[model samples]
Target: MALVPASARTWLWHEHAAVPLTDAPPVVTHLAWPPHSRSRPLAALVRTAARLAAPDTAPTP
Candidate 1:
């Protein structure tokens, strides 16, 4: 039984046959990367993660 964000419940349930603990406390997540890294793919991934973490701050078309 792992603790994960509610947003991941569906994917984890479908992909890993995992079940949620209804009484579990919420989890806080953080992302980190090298401050001087120059990987384009990693940058893109960080951007995507930021968007998902805070949809309200994501730019709209």
Candidate 2:
């Protein structure tokens, strides 16, 4: 299974909204990862989950 959900792509898109990620609305983002990604750390994942779960406004970029 993908390490992160398909929606996880939105976090990255919010980071780079200046350019369009796809030719569509709702601003969807898609990503692919290895079955086992060693580069990502557990702590980072936890932090990212917390941020994503918490309420926030759209990115200002």
Candidate 3:
């Protein structure tokens, strides 16, 4: 299953999920960030990686 952070929900919901996977569609899990989060950018990057890693998905800018 692919895990995406909540900050990336907008892009993921609109663009990421349409791409097909080699296997089954991964169950997307949404992760939350705490207030004054230092990990927000990291979370977004991870989410981008998850999307890019899908066999049929294009690399997101």
**Which candidate tops lDDT?**
1
lDDT of 2 by residue, 1-61 (tens): 2344355666665544334345445534333457676655754664565566526632322
Residue 48 lDDT in model 3?
Answer: 81
What would the per-residue lDDT of candidate 1 be over residues 1-61, giving only the tens digit for each residue? 5666667766664547556578766665676788999999988987887777657755553
Going through the candidates in the order shown, the clash numbers are 0, 0, 0
Task: Sort by lDDT, best first.
Answer: 1, 3, 2
Kindly report which residue stretches of model 3 are placed more than 4 angstroms away from their true locations once superposed.
Answer: 1-38, 56-61
TM-score of 3: 0.27
TM-score rank, highest first?
1, 3, 2
> Which is the better candidate, 1 or 2, if ranked by TM-score?
1
Give the poorly placed runs of model 2, Cα more than 4 Å off: 1-24, 41-50, 53-61
